[model samples]
Target: MVERATSLACDPSASETGRLLTQAFQTIRDDLEVRQAFPEAALAEIEQAVADPELPERDETDVEFVTIDPPGSMDLDQAMHISRDGAGFRVRYAIADVPAFLHEGGALDAETRLRGQTIYCPDTRVPLHPPALSEEAASLLPDAVRPAYVWDIRLTADGERETAELYRAMVRSRRRYTYTEAQELIDGGDAEEALLLLKEVGELRIAREIDRGGASLPMPEQEVGVGTEEDGCDYTLSLRPLLPAEDWNAQISLLTGMVAARIMLDGGVGILRTMPEPTEGAVARFRREVEALGAQWPEGMPYGEFLRTLDRTDTRHLAIVNAATFLFRGAGYTAFDGELPPEDEQVQSAIAAPYAHVTAPLRRLVDRFGLAVCEALSAGREVPDWARAALPDLPDVMEETGRRAKAVDRACVTAVEAAVLRDRVGEDFEAVVVDGVDGDRVQVQLMDPPVSDVATGSARLGSAITVRVERADILAGEVDLRIVGRDEQ
Candidate 1:
């Protein structure tokens, strides 16, 4: 009878806990204003274009691009295929061509600008572009000939870039593969010819980048899942490693972003994403923490250089390295009107150079704006007045939108975690200390069914301990855990 009651407390439906979760989600959805009012004439034009039997002509014969994304994802934006060219590799990146369908100064454009970017909440999403366009017409789906802005990158065997070219084109994707499927193929040596070549090129590029002081942090991420008959909604914190192919693909985007930044810098009148390097005081504090945790980072080197070294070490110090990375300043958009940013703020360590995000136009508004600027500059014409006017406000808008998106995402994850743990009030679990903020509540990571929570602890950050789940409120989106024991010194 006790076991039955415990099980009922965490039921997917009918349980008080589940009902509270559902209600919380409903409240969030209601506040998002899902129904956006778009101009009718613009909608009619877009529908008419998609409905036409004959679309624009495209050549998709030389390259067979394929998309890799999460399962059940509808708004695919990128496709890639790689091949060997002499002693180097040719990487073809095809991004969805959203601008082709958009009429300048149209209703859809206004609506997208208002929304800024996609906001993903627990139960709903405030998409930047309407689903009819973003998910269906503009998505680069398998067997679909879609318009795209393609970048062709050529790299030597040692992963040094030899040449690059950018142009607009149409492409047909040969297949759609998930991350897991692609990983299996690459690991088992059974990947398709194109995918195999891509993986090899990616490996070389990653090695070279790391050698050139590029830092990659390996941090554990939390993923939420809707449970089945046995369990209610659960939160699983897992280690998601970057696959070779994924890194290879990311390099293409990063390369383009750097190129975009260079172009803007040379042109002397454009918007840029800039981030200042970490301060010496901040680096010293982080070093103290590292030493306290009995970790070794190279002495007498720049912070960025030290970070690169830490990232290449064993898994035990992974979280510490991540915490160190947090000390760096955030990246933001800045307008350069024939003058450079303040000398101290001109460099961005994230991209290894100042950059503007010109990829992922289907999902991001900034990328679309940047693409428009690139097009105008390439044509030897001045940027549109509206786009140029947007330069001043783009920074604040991007920052505000980014903050809101992060809040919504975190709130949803927290609500789900609370729902999952509501029934196990007194269960003990093993956890690692993630942070020791506020002195009273230290954040810890739990194992069995992974989750992160604040607990009372004597040890500081990076300490491992056992904790008991004390209380949880699904609607409030909170979980209370208490430290029961610590690892012996």
Candidate 2:
């Protein structure tokens, strides 16, 4: 239930809590053996590759393209140019051409395969590619012409996708607007045609997503902060509300991925990002939990639509979002060479469509190969033998890397959670038991501070109660609480 955003701030020198968190994060990295730096061979290869990249013959730099991303992000992966195309729209989406710079099976390729994707930890970020490439050279930085996998998609007046094609090209981004900046422009009516069309197309795609039974988790993001006061240090986890521009931008990526999957399937080879639907039992449990959280789950409402109703600003609703993570189970990569996956297994149930990871090649290894495969297929050329051969092993590589990343995330968040609550040892909090009520231990969520953890006490699940904090260990990332009494009022 952890959603890590770009850190709001960090000050290890100012406070003990900050120092403890830094030490804990480093310990996890050391314990897990996560690569802190690229190997010399990989770095050397990246340097040589940057010096002489194989740029595309096609030039799309004349079309003014802009990127919308998180503030301070440098490893930009995508750029877009939207324009009117006869009663509908023309969307030109450009993805970073990692394949242009990377040699198959080289040292850099080996390094990125192991890292899998960039891990965004609070203390530090573990990048998939070296900063020289991911941040400076190969990144889709504004005003810098670079090779990219460009998707030219045509949409109907109803905002439905009509036709899509991909090709390699030399492109340049004119400006980079953060999500907030993009949203401000749209709201203030000062945005260009591309930015305005984004919102229009995004809402239509979202509607289509719901109509198609797509369920996406709107994970609440939190920013960790450490501040120095006159008396002591204060540590807090604050919710960072997501802007509408983020969702609009994501729709563009999703649209391209769906189109890429179609191409891969049509071409008779490639991999897919896949997931299975939640079981009936899981849905039932979620319904009961939603009711327990003081919300109504109207009968027959799809969980995805119900999720869209959640208010991210409300702490109670945020807990509902946290609890909904259970439905995001069984997500993984499925690779195929000749025969397509059985009709039933082909769909990514979460998106209610056939989807491929064709975006974000800068940060994800699979996307690099995916883009290469799609580009070759779109060009009516033979699929690269290296990419075809590597399909079988991709699923396993991604799973291993994803598992390790999740473990690191849980540890870091647990330590931060404990550290935040350590100061109030004897305080009583109004809490609701969310799980484990039948046993000696139960998981409780505080109403005020929005912390949830296992407490050694007996209570009915979902019942409001008063709890006293007994112990919290920052280094161990552990907390102890005992329920004193039930809250009747």
Give the candidate number with the greatest TM-score: 2
Q: Model 2, 1-489: lDDT tens per residue?
A: 343334344444368777787777788888877888889999999889999998899999998999988767899999999999999999999999987788888898888889998877666678999988899888999999989989999999877889988999999999999888999999999999999999999998899899988887776565554444543444566546677888888888998999999999999899999988888999898898888777988898899999988876665465577667788889899999888899767788889999999889888889988988998998899998899999999999999998888888777777777887888888989887756645688877776566667777787655788898899888777778889888644
In order, what lDDT does every prediction score?
Answer: 0.69, 0.83
Off by over 4 Å in 2: 1-10, 225-236, 291-294, 432-438, 447-450, 458-465
CA displacement after TM-score superposition, residue 448 of candidate 2 (Å): 5.2
- How does model 2 fare in lDDT? 0.83
- Judge candidate 1 at residue 34 and give its lDDT: 35
The prediction achieving the highest lDDT against the true structure is: 2
After TM-score superposition, the amount by which residue 155's alpha carbon in candidate 2 deviates from its true location, in angstroms, is: 1.3
